[model samples]
Target: MAKRRITQETFDAAVRENMEEFEMASEEALREAVEQFESQGVDLTCIVKAVAAVSSEDTPEESTHEVLQALDSLRIGDNSASVTEVEADMKRFTEHCLVGFAQRFLAAQKDAYPVILSHCKKSVEEPEALVNALSALAALTNGQPDLLEAEGKQLFLDVLKKHREDPSVTCVAVRTVRHCCLKHEQNRQDLVKGGVLPLLTGAVTQHSESAALVKEASAALRVMCYDDDIRATFGNAHEHAKSIVLEHKGLKVLIQAAKTHFEDTSVLSELCATLSRLAVRNEFCQDICDLGGLKLMMTLLADSYETAELVRQVLSALRALAGNDDVKDAVVNAGGVQYIVIAMNRHMNNAAVCEQGCGCLSVLALRKPENCQVIMENGGALAAVQAMKTHTNSLNVQNQACMLMRNLVARMPQYSQPILDMGAEALIAQALLTHQYIADVGKAALRDLGCQVELRELWTGEHGSLSY
Candidate 1:
């Protein structure tokens, strides 16, 4: 072996030459070189010499272009050179080469992304290449989604449209959808119209699809459903109402699935959440109530701990159906009042779920006075009263519990005395001191207990320590 000492001048010249030769390097040669370098513990000086030697060119312009060309070609599966050959070139001697290569490719060719998408979809069957290609798409679109040109978008749509039938590909495609679209309104519409739904739905039905991918799709759907105008524009809300509630018997599928696949919280959460929203309409509510929605929601509350959204969904459904006597009794029968009370007071858990459960319990109290006893027995009165007093700082919790308390005392006046004796009035009065909106709620609950505090009465000292 010739012992060669590498100088800065020698290093630069060798790197420049390697860059030129990179365009002609075989993937096989590259891999072999990589293997050799790894086995022998490659010298950094040798790598620099090789790169400069490979990139050396007769002209400066040609040298830079060839170096960029070689760097760009460092991507997977070229047979003419050893991967080690290319990696050593870039890893030790050519990071600037990598950035310069990427930037030049991005700037010089608007078609670069589409080419990358093509690789992700077709050029590379290897999962590693597919992953890398998808990653590149993510980085390119992270801040400049518009960087995904029309051709690239169509390329992505084409690749994912059919090939995503494979679970791995489908999962990757779901992620790509987020990156490629981000917040682009038109891109989102393209996904809906381009048959992304059926593919997603197909993947959703497949037990083998990753929990994460299904969850991501569910999240996207949840957002889409929230925008009533968008749903109306796409006609998805109508589909939601029709499928989940009525004509097609969709809820049956979920209930059946739940019996066997209880372990998959993602499945149950998405199904229950969808059912909750659909059940908000009057006809849908009656339909869900008829279909044992109460039992299923209770099951979700008791058995699932996947996400707080699942808990909130069950609570929301309970509240929607609370006007029905059967629904309220079902809630009490299901041990909902006790669980909800624990959630609010002792659990100090998710604030959203706590408020929703309270709303449902309040509604239950209004429909069935019998259920009111459950609330009291489970410390519901104390929780509600405490919410009125201590949560004056949190408007959402205060407003929700106060509204529920008003309903509780209004329907079951017999419980009002105990509720007041629990310091309900003190809590209500505290809230009244801050926000006028809930001031009426405090007064109303107090009034229901036959102890409305008139300022004049306070001055008279006729009523001592009367609380809501």
Candidate 2:
């Protein structure tokens, strides 16, 4: 059981003799040979030959350093080449106690992805190696894979099993799980089972730790719940998102997260958007309004550009719940109408933002006629119509403008007639004549108004008669 010094083995016969006694060597003895062999001028080939004679279990953890040195000694043609040979060895070394040696090289070092992935690339094929390799990589990126999405999910199960309790570890694994849910439908149930809701839910509720980490968990969960593409990415996450809002106490945590991190605009953007979804659930919507989300969001809309975007993103959320009597009244009580119209008019900076602001007004217009009157009188509807002519080249602006026109028309058929009378029809026609990007929707919007005009009806409507 005493440690032994590694000696020169010149040929197969010497190595074979060592192999015979390899079984008797203690862990420390095997480590001493691997640790001290190189300074003695022992050739690497001989060291490897000796390494093969030893059992995989007794392979020195420190041997990883020697192995990397030995591997580094092998000529790498380029950075790409350097990564490739190590990758092949990782595949070749599957579960070799020496594998950890390569893993440490990849995971612990900064900006070491190219090197770490070089070894992890083949983990998809070898399950045993995949788990350990993925664990090491997860340990580094907070568990999110910078690699391709598909392979990361396949490798996540093992990470879940080994690191279930560590918050950073669990957070990372849950991230990969969300990544999987968003990228493919096949893995959604698996995502739910891997404790994603609970993992994210627990972190959102725990107020004692890193506000930074808690905010991150809240964000990932928020994205899964609200973004339609992500919902379609994994059909089940929508159900999970909807269910959490409906049944679990997760809503309280999100409200807390927003209240705590709102000063951080980036985090607030996420918080506001999540509140938008929670606003869809009957119980959650009332709770969100009662929490003064509208006042906070309206303030964000009036802030700098970055803060305004949070308002734009939450527009759909507002639109979704605008029909609710309580939430609708909440918007009016919070001065939501004035803030939105100002963003579209005075803040007409980004055509996309202008369009979204206008679009949000249209949603409010449909359900609240008083809100619509405030918009029309405040010059919102005209500003949007003008933006269509000004931003004819921007499809996002054009489409959003057209969508708003649709909402405006829905209220008073008479409302859109004045826009046409003001040459909006001609501008739309000219836009259709020159820009084909949104011409069909553009022309259709124009045509819809042209056919709906009733001069007498306009004279009778609110905002009454205006000579054009």
Candidate 3:
């Protein structure tokens, strides 16, 4: 039988009663409330499991957070008479939600979504209040994505359409859209069908100079490409990614945005990562190369060697683009191999850079012997070996390293001695023993490199018989 569950409000109210009526300590009250609820077979997994913050002394109300107080203020006001107080009330609510996740979760349990969204509907004509209301909504929906259902999501799109020219309002509105659509597949599809891709890219184009707006808008655009809703069965992530590239020209918009914020590594990282996500097709990869994305990526890689995050993202984009045969050659011809090696050597301690760097080489050297020579000549093999040795704890780094090693020696077996001389055998063997999942690739890498590897058979042509 299924145990019954109680609302968070009920549990919190009981805790407050314990603290106020029995004059118990906050800790004792919380423990007692938890014990009492469980004794009655009421599940409390969804509850926040904490005492409410004390209300300010001047209020003389029951103990409540400032966020809830502000919520009550807006709930009791007459829409026509309290127009002026909406902005301040929304700002106050937004500030409290920003304090932490617990506050946001608590506020959501108190039905803050409709209360705050009502302000968004009422203040559409007032820019300041609208922005404040949108900002508050964005914050309140941060961890509570289910709050943005049919009505809330439509209002979000409507806000974007109504305030298209207002960058300030659009920035917060896009942010709100991102927060709501994060784990909700239905919201993502609905927003995309409502022309959100164009609005997001247009925001990037219109506010190219505003890093804040571009960052928010770019993040929202990337969120559209996610297929993260667990309930979805084979989600529309690929279709959405294709739409952003074909229907909306996402590649050109993101690359141009990266150029505008070239000096800003933070923005460049976001844009490059987005570009990688959008590179879902072979022609799209070529499109990125033709659109000067390769040049921009190389330049960023060269200039941002010291910035581990930017370097990691650039290498990731390069790795994605190199999926095309032509782009692989183009990457090698443009001195990309050497740049990647240098970045890996520079940020050897950063597991992500090393992993992505090895992945780039692994892709570039796939079935292309000439590109393999370029990778080996440019210290690609040595960088990968060092990465394997440095980040022994990182399975991704180890896996990518083994894969790169396999690619390097797969076509050109002559390079095997030098790689072995670099002490790859020990690392590869240790990795094969340490991690079970990498056994297939790691064993294949060892075998191709002319090293002795154990091969096991699990089945034979005997009825009802298994062998290991």
Candidate 4:
């Protein structure tokens, strides 16, 4: 039997007929239309467009499934078709909201993974097809981790190693790996064990000019470092991840990527997030500061209002860095105290931001009377007090706020007068009344504020005694 030739008129007529019987069109009618279009050699794009045009917004689930099945039945060659064709088909399926349905379809077919893997393996030999196939594989396996873990993981890793020098292939491979590990902790651990980190970090360094590559690579690293087990290695006692990163001079690579593509917020966000995770340890904090992490973080904090998560990560990194006196001073010299105060006030409603902001201020105020003065002059004290008052119910915020105030009163008693002028005693008394565990610290702050009368009244009211 000879295949029919499809003309625009034929396509238009089919679309009109489907639209006229949109609600009445049975699954059989939809399947027949797909078969007719395929027999006529109409491009899948045209077929999809025609289907989308005739399909009502409330198209029946059965009809959608039938359309997906019809499209999947087409003999779209993995190797013979132009890369553009394959890419177009993949994008079209996704655009028609069929990827999830396709995954379901593939799951039921036991040989689905082997077929896709076969194409992927061949596509890698042809560079153009390789990118397209890799992209298609990524789309197909996305959110289908079992399929990936079972078949695609080693294939992607092999591609990553074989084409490590090709930026395009490397980018897609890293992105696929990222998709594989997302929401799958075991996959993340396996990737780490398979030495995926070095490849990803290398991508970040070698492809500095390729923002897409850098962004994907950075995103992969961010996910890899997301696990608590992996992140724990960056702690004071464990520097495993940090050691590898710094050993490969990964921090410098990251800092340069951040500087090179300063305007790419996704890259910046992911890169900053990765650096922040690595900066969890004290030694890494100093390493970050040594590599000019403070300046980048402060710059990010300057734009805190526009990017809340970025600001959150920067604050976390800053908190770690501020634990070092020299870094604290450097941060202050960089106008960090003022930025932090602004961040607190700007994002007053965000508890995480508030918690991290107060945490940073607390460290800066510890044993550093000058920092306390800077905080006071810059309204940091009022900000800290306000954080406590606003998030009075948040124990972390309360504890951090109390600790900041405790440091202020303990290290610099002279600043207590200004604090008292700001109604510090009432705040302390409230904190005392609210959090009894910090009652002693709050009471001490009140005494530092020359509020002995109020302190005694608080204790007397609570204990029914003026023993102290």
Candidate 5:
């Protein structure tokens, strides 16, 4: 039997018939249709196109399952169809909403790991195939990162090193690494051990023009930095994340990227998050501020309406930078105090922003009476009290708010009467009574509020004894 001659009319009619059958096909019928199409040598692209034409709302789960099975059966690697065949199959899967099949196929097929690994190894000369293969690996191991850590870690690192010149390849490679590192500590440690930071930093600093590369690299760093062990490895006694970033000249790279892509909120958000993570070390606070991180953060808080993520990161970074007196003075001079208060009020419902806002106020109010006065003038004290009252269940917010209140009243004697009048004492009392773990901070705040004797008596009455 000769191959059926599939003319344009024949192909279109086949697609139309398949589309009609697909709309009403049951699971078994869909499987049969897939078998018939494959047996007739119908182009996979046509089937994908026909299925894609159906309204996604009406596409049955069985149809998706059959389509995924057919697409995954496409041959890849040497001695098989050309790279174009595998790439087209992958493109179709990704484009036609069948990408979910990547994970399912890999999960069901025991040999998928070796098969994808072989293809990735052979496709080094082919960037498109390499990217698609990496993407497939990423999808397969997305939530299941042990697969990548066990097999594909070195493969991905090699891709980043060898294909640094190709922004597309670099982008997908870093993104794959980022996905593997998502919520998986072993994968993150492997990435750090594999020297991912230098590769990612090089991608950002050396290839500054590729916004996609920079964004993905920044995002990868952001995820990697979340691990305290990784952060400690990057930071030292004199600097937090700043030492490592500065060692690779990554700070300048990141700063330049933030400046260059000022409008790209995704880039800025990740970059700022990375900075905030680094600034967690007290030693890096002054360095971050001196390196112009303070100015950039102030600008972002002042202008961008992108998302709460950026605002959250900006407030967090400011909270870290405000630890140093010089940095605190600079922040106040840059009108950061006002913006911090604004963030508090704008995202009043966001516990994280409220916590960080109050944190910044707490640190700034520590030694700077003038800064404390500035906070009081900008309603920082009231905001802190309100945040504590609003997030009564959040021990973090309550503790930080208590610290802020204590700092404000302790440093600026003039603002003590104003804070008391705002009913901060009531909020503190509530925190003391509700959260015993934070009772110490609350008790200290009461003392700072000029109610030490009353707080002692209240504590004794509540607990039958007073420890502090």
Candidate 6:
């Protein structure tokens, strides 16, 4: 037989009973309640395991903050509230939520999720109340992803479906969706299964003129494609990315939004980053190229090369798109080599830009001898060596620079000595000595560039054969 379990309410009731009837201390009562439940084989992992603070309506003696008081007012159990009452309460809650995470954590501990969820459910027909409720929900769930359960997931998708025509509602709803799904893999999977990709793409397409809405929806789309949640043994992040591109035509939608928001550097940065996230497969890489994404990225790079953050994103997108052989040729032919070199030169002090720029050049020079000459002639090698010299403390930049040097000289050894003359050997040796885990690429760069590298023999067979 399975072990019996009890609800948190039941456990709390037991603790409260011990406190009031038996005159036990609060801590003693909690301990007794825990022991009593564990003795009965009742699982308490889901229980909050704390005495109920003065957060509810009946508890008038204990003091609570205004945020908790506002949450208490929004509790919609038996009381009937007018539209104005709901709107006022939701607005108060949203304002309080904006205060900070301390108040949000307090409210979450007080079971504010269901109270706010109740308001979201009740205000579905009331646009004013619904938007305020969603804004509060979004703020409340920020970094409190444990509050978003199965019901919360369904409510998010339902709100998106119902309010698809309302950009204001969809915008906040998407913000809430992004907050709920971040660092919560199950929520991401569930929302994507509930057909969120098409809705997100539609939001981007429908509200193309609204830069704020487009940015939020685009960010949410990118969040769905993240595999950062560590709780799951495996995730469907790749599948979601594919669904966004192959099934829902996400490339066209994002590329169009990028064009629409070309002047908005913030929105363009987000779109470029999301574009990199969506380019997970080789065909998807080619799809980005065919959809004019390559040209758009080059233009963005040219226009925003001075903008460090935007330059980094554009370089990342180029690196992702360069995974394809034909895309590599396309990028090289479209002045990509020169753009990457210029971006790196402009942002020589920015480690992230240097990393992405070196990575892009490395991929463009991989296995393509013709492109290697273009990279060499365009100061790509010098830019990479300088990136290493500038960001010596940045292991990512060093590793990427090492890879770029190797790729530049892998097929076209004629450019090796020219690059080595630019102080490549010293930086490569320093990187190899500094970061052991990433030294393989650095070591290969040194060896391929005609520098003598010490080959460490790790294991030996019985016949004296060795392996690294």
Per-residue CA lDDT of model 5 for 1-468, tens digit only, reads 544434323433454455566664434444555567669765443232223223255643323333344345544324577767777765554443334543334333444555556777888889988888777666655555556645578888788889989998899889888877876666777767777778988899877777788888887877776553332344222332443466666666787888888888887877887776666555567767767888899999899633677888888777777766788899999998888888888888889888888888888888888888888889898898889878998889999999998888786666777888988888888887788999778888888788753444535435466687
Per-residue lDDT tens digits for candidate 4, residues 1-468, read 644445333554565566567643545555767676777665544233334332454643223333343235323455576666665654553343334543333332434455556667877777766776666556655665556664566777778888888999998888878877766666776666677778888888878999899989877776666554342343221333564466667678888899898776777777777776666556667788778777888887786446777777778878877767788899999999989888889889888889888888989988888888898889988988788778877777877777787788787777777777777677767777777787666666666666774444435435455675
Q: Report the Cα lDDT for candidate 4.
A: 0.69
Q: How many residue pairs clash in each candidate?
A: 42, 0, 0, 0, 0, 0
lDDT of 3 at 462: 69
Better of 4 and 6 by lDDT: 6
- Taking all chains together, each candidate's TM-score versus the true structure is 0.59, 0.59, 0.88, 0.66, 0.73, 0.83
**What does the lDDT read for residue 286 in candidate 5?**
75
| Alpha-carbon local distance difference test for all models | 0.57, 0.56, 0.88, 0.69, 0.71, 0.87
> What lDDT does candidate 3 reach at residue 21?
96
Better of 3 and 4 by lDDT: 3
Candidate 6 lDDT at 450 equals: 94
Give the Cα-based TM-score of candidate 3 against the true structure. 0.88
Arranged by lDDT with the best first, the candidates are: 3, 6, 5, 4, 1, 2
Stretches of candidate 1 off by over 4 Å are 1-128, 135-160, 176-190, 228-261, 264-271, 283-293, 303-313, 320-326, 366-370, 388-390, 435-468
* True-structure RMSD, every candidate: 14.9, 17.9, 4.2, 12.1, 11.4, 7.8
Least well predicted 10-residue stretch by lDDT in candidate 4: 231-240
Model 2 C-alpha lDDT per residue in residues 115-211, reported as the tens digit of each score: 4444445544544544444443544343222333444444455454454455555554455455434444445555555455665666666542555
> Per-residue lDDT of 1-468 in model 1, one digit per residue for the tens?
644333334334444344456643534444544444445654433232222223444555333333335335644323454545534433321233234333423322444454445545553455544555565555445434556666666665665655665666556556666555554555655666665555545555563335665655444444333333332344354454454335435445444544444677666676666555555455666666667666766666666634576667666767776666666676788788876666566434466766776687778777566777778788887887665555567666667777777777676777777877887777766777777776666577667777757632337546578699
Worst 10 residues of 2 by lDDT: 101-110
Write down the TM-score for model 4: 0.66
Error of 5 at 381 (Å): 0.8
